[model samples]
Target: MSETFVDLGFVTAPSGVVVLGMAGWIDYWREVGEPLSVRAGVAAKAGGGYLREEECEAVAVPAAADRPLAVRATTEPSMFDEEPTIATLEIELGLPWPEGVDGPVLLGDLPVDRSGMVIGDGVGLDAWTGQEDEPADGLGDVTFWGRYEEDAHARFGGERIPHPGGVDGVYGWLDVPMAEAVALEAEISTWRGGVWGQGVAGSVEPHVDYFRFRRAGLHHPLNVGAIEVGGCQVLGIDWCQGDHSVRHHGGRDWGQAFPVTLEADGTGGTVLRWTIPPYDEDEEG
Candidate 1:
């Protein structure tokens, strides 16, 4: 059996850095009976105020090239009252061990491989806010934010996938069978959201998290050889802390599939093209 490698890309909003968690902040604001606006600012003395912490752990598996890699992370709340903070992250790919190279080099704690290496740079956060004073469905003025990195440069054994405009949220490619790809697309298309019980809050008002699919409209799925691709417009809403909320609304078109190709040894797989947005306004039907 020969070796196989798949190219993957991921993007998400940078974690929020705050002195208090969302629940605590909302409670404090309610106690004061006022709305609050917080932003990240430079601190003169680092030891006194609350310090926000974000940590992410990811593992790349050579065997599972067909499914998205699961990443686990945690962000700690600030200990003291202070300005909000933000942290930037850089994602890199670890290559295989070289043919003649003697030793190894570490890419963040993971040992490098010999296949090849490529890095995606300038991936960061983007925020979206709802209309001022207009609460949707009686929730509250909402703000939704996440990460977007432009021009992800991905290469697997000399094959490349370039994101010229930009890639939103998190995206990647795996070399699974056609049936598995279709199943994955269906799972993503039907996701509505979930509920968070008092485990994080403790009150009867459970945090309601939901996203309305086909909010903009539905885009049908496509089957091309070994690849299956599909996506639709989505409006995601999260209501916590009694009335505070966040929403993610975006438009997606049926046309245009971001193409990805995987190669290992001397064998190549069918190019898988998946739909992504920031859609072209002119191309929307």
Candidate 2:
């Protein structure tokens, strides 16, 4: 079950290993640890960088091999840093809106009661490159993941990018229409935090890698997602965008959090399973 439109471009990793590439994009990925980098604050992702050859719309469904998978604002109020904070790291593979019309909603859970999150050390992640003065980089376990806005050549079919009044992304209405193509699955497990049993993500020795992005579905409301920093990593920007070139065996598994799953196979199609978990041990401390 593989769909298409072609030309993918956007991904990163470095905190433990998650990869998202933002914060100015000189290579990005820096912050390791400091108490959630100041309560999950580092204010990264202005334009979120990387994505060219302009081409959107993607899909996938191959199985086997596994592994893998944010925040914004960064400044603007002064006086020895009075009080400033802005962060956005979207990653929704279909949320609470799953009682019918399909199943499986565990991208990260915790929308209210799905309760469960832990991508290693409880997601506060550290060490891929942290604090040197702190201007960039925050959390991304396992090491670097790749993909950057090739220069924002944004172009995804075009027209229709309204919806924006708060709730930055992951908004669902499901009238159904934005699924022209964008599915690629192949992430059995590559976290090992809880050891394959604690909410989710508990396996290892399965890393051929496979992480795409920009697979947020539904156009009715169109608050869709796919940006692990601040905003606009191609969120229906150019609109009908497309760029899917997968091989199956996989080779990219860092920022699998921003929307990048590649497993190969063939079937009816229509599968969204992402209930991630694993990272307790006082968050590996």
Candidate 3:
């Protein structure tokens, strides 16, 4: 079968770079503390220092960060041979499922993925914070994640529930059908590069990292996208530029992920395929 590619849209890189990872930065600005205030052109001033929102390109909303993020939708999940752990630093993982299993891990309920806005010359999570590095060549890492819980389970965790896909009465209703081996398939095409997609890609541009910083540990899945004004991810760090924009196909309905089957393999190894869209959180409603 021909390779199926999906474009999520563009991510603005006004400073010539972008940061990708979990929503830890979002948690910092929106939840953890008050945002920084703009002191000058595209720069938010803090006690320690500031970051420049210099524009390498024009954008929408006069400064909003935006960009195109595409994905290689796949059903063929890359299997691990030795079940290697993906981290070096040990930290707590607040997962609902046990460790050791192929899971579409949801980043929402994370105990890690933390950040602060500090760094030397002012680049780090908070202060002591500076722009996190993406490959100097303008590329970041990409990988896959599956839920640590059961691959297939009814959306509501109940066996009997009518209209499992919609709000029969209220949100979190038990009527939704079970989702198995399901996930937000990714590895962006258009807007590529980042520490990780968290759940999606950012497609950051080169030299843009100077103004962008990301946190480590836990985060909401869409945190990366939230950072972009399409151009502005750091709050209070403002500038005079048009808003950046992006396009995505994450609006597909439940169990309606796009699929492309591979030629049958007789080998004993398992080959699973999945059809996925851009993971539009709007569909949850």
Candidate 4:
């Protein structure tokens, strides 16, 4: 049989330069008994020694600070984590792989094979905070996600044309029978980089991670794909700018793909399990 596989490149690009490498002076502005504050931007002075919104950029408040109003101000360069631990995503494809194993490695920077790839509708579940990443009680598709791409040059407000051949990859969804499709409900879960503690903190661009589906059912407003098979396995990578962006596929690590597995556990229901690689956290820094 011919190979039934394809690769779709990532949608967005990644950041290249290491933010901390640049040389800049940062003044550590702190009060004796106040929460350590990291000025984000400019603010104006509202009261005594207080910079208002115009004079400063942004400020961070520690959860465990003694003084409620004690703030810090300085003209020093800020230090941020270049690679922040974003979120984790997992979804169980009910059907087994061709050899009872996982599928091929997907590079996110590759281009979607419009001819072979099917951009179907799909949904995203808010499951990170829950046991099973599924809607607690909703029967129908609750969350929906879409697939979109921003022209690299347009995003940067540049006039450079993307390299010839654009990108190359294949993506599509193959539906499992209704009985099987219904048997497999999305147990997709995702997590994002949270509050930046003293050990770690940073900001992120507004970009949605999309999973295009082939099987149609319920879809997330910002997700991609159709729910057909008993389950699904998606692929992509964290990307960075310059040559590194090409490497990451989209500031994501194409090297790893989250695999969510669901199987019958004797009683005819489903047993779900997911595997995610260990990543760096803010603590223990």
Candidate 5:
């Protein structure tokens, strides 16, 4: 078993305009008897392309450390679109790992909390892998099975959004050691029309390389899709949010509906089951 530590920080303009918040987690594969240490900082790159270091203040202590991660001093937002400025959170491992340890690994999912922004209501995780010092130009080597957020629901001005459901956190793990030459890739497609895997009121052709995973996990939440896993074809769906109902429309007369649940079988496997409800006639498409 491995131990993981998560670090979170935020940066904003002096006026409190949020630049970005970052959350990073590292996994320790080897057993270390001593406590681990972490240090964090921030850097800024203005629209003019000049990089500058900034002062940071810690607001919250990390899970593994007594000190807070560093945050950047707020700066003015760019006046023009072309001059977009960037604030980057910098985190470093304060102590060395034991020999034969594979990580201090960082995921591309920064887990930023940019609430109230027009960029929609959620953060997205990217699939990529590389050494901390190496450029990330190649495809990811890990299998990203899926991600979920917790406590992601938000309210604006005392009114809940039409769709208030969102995830606040994600959980995943490495299924296998990564090979340097392997790249993350996957395909996605959809089928609409006629029910029961038959009849075609509409059809969606295959989308090559539409999605990729660094590892294998239950990723898709709404519909059944097939992907090649371990050289075998597997179908999976995920409704990660609890108490949420999903409707599957197949043609005009046939459809499937269910509430999803994720269960662990206690043998390092996850079981996904759908509590399908009886068909409802009043539901609008």
Candidate 6:
């Protein structure tokens, strides 16, 4: 259970830890819903990136070190400036997808222009440095569940949604076409306020550290905030369009949403899930 497709390239600092450079290359914009065709210079190395050499069409890596895991971050928007924010850090990858496919929808492709794609870091830029020194615990009791974008409905509740479309948390992939049977729906956004359970890092730990500084999914996606003063760093995108279905809610606790079972695996690819929730808590003091 270890698929591979390496093009080699990875670097995520600011403490969210996502660095894998025996080489380099990281330009993400691969969605698959209604924006299908994104594959921006995806290359990661150190041992095996590019999903470990495509792993038979899509099995990236990590088939049984756990499950379907290959989470990523650094959704570039020039990092960030003022409005449009979301992306503190997240990497919950168990890995698995491409073995008799079953309702696999996660797509996004309609924005391609990879500036030559060469996110270099041969140990140079300090590996895309970002850890100021430890000091980011703003979002107090964080919790922003899921299921939201029907049309967004103005982000419901307390409307303040900004960034890409202000819907929060989402990646890309989904274009099913063979033996089809898809039904993938993910509109669960969360980042409740107050620097919630802060823990920015860059991982490669002990050989592999599936960092779960819980405050969101492991249990911490409820209004997290705190940490501002010239803050800037937001990048969250999610989309899934037409025919999709997946089912595997048998063991990893899918009570509060976390059950993947994508079924249609061909001309229907789209299930983008990009996240970076760490809303700045200062700036205006």
* lDDT digits (tens) for residues 1-285 of candidate 5: 011222222211121111111111111101122111112111111100111122111111111122222221111122222221222223221222334534322221212111110000011111111123222223322211121111111110111211213232222112222333122111100122223333212111111112222112222222123333222222222222222222332321333322222223234332222223333558646
Q: lDDT: which is higher, 1 or 6?
A: 6
TM-score, per-candidate, Cα-based: 0.16, 0.17, 0.20, 0.17, 0.17, 0.17
Identify the leading candidate in terms of TM-score. 3
For each predicted model, how many residue pairs clash, with residues at least 3 apart or on different chains? 14, 67, 80, 73, 15, 136
RMSD of each: 23.8, 23.8, 23.6, 26.9, 22.8, 21.5
TM-score of 3: 0.20
TM-score of 2: 0.17
Question: Which 10-residue window of candidate 5 scores lowest in summed lDDT?
Answer: 116-125
The candidate with the higher lDDT, 2 or 4, is 2
lDDT of 3 at 49: 16
Best candidate (score: lDDT)? 3
Which residue runs of candidate 4 sit more than 4 Å off their true CA positions?
1-222, 227-268, 277-285
> Rank by lDDT, descending?
3, 6, 5, 2, 4, 1
lDDT of 3 at 210: 29
Which ranges of candidate 6 are over 4 A from the true structure? 1-99, 104-234, 237-257, 260-285
In angstroms, the error of model 2 at 130 is: 24
Q: What is the lDDT of candidate 1?
A: 0.19
| Per-residue alpha-carbon lDDT of candidate 6 for residues 176-252, written as tens digits (9 for 90 to 100) | 22122111111222222212243111111110001111111221122121111112111112111110011111111
lDDT of 3 by residue, 24-121 (tens): 24323323233222221233111011221221111111111233222122122212222111111111111123235343322111111222211111
Backbone clash total, candidate 4 = 73
Once model 4 is optimally superposed onto the true structure by TM-score, how far is the C-alpha of residue 102 displaced, in angstroms?
Answer: 20
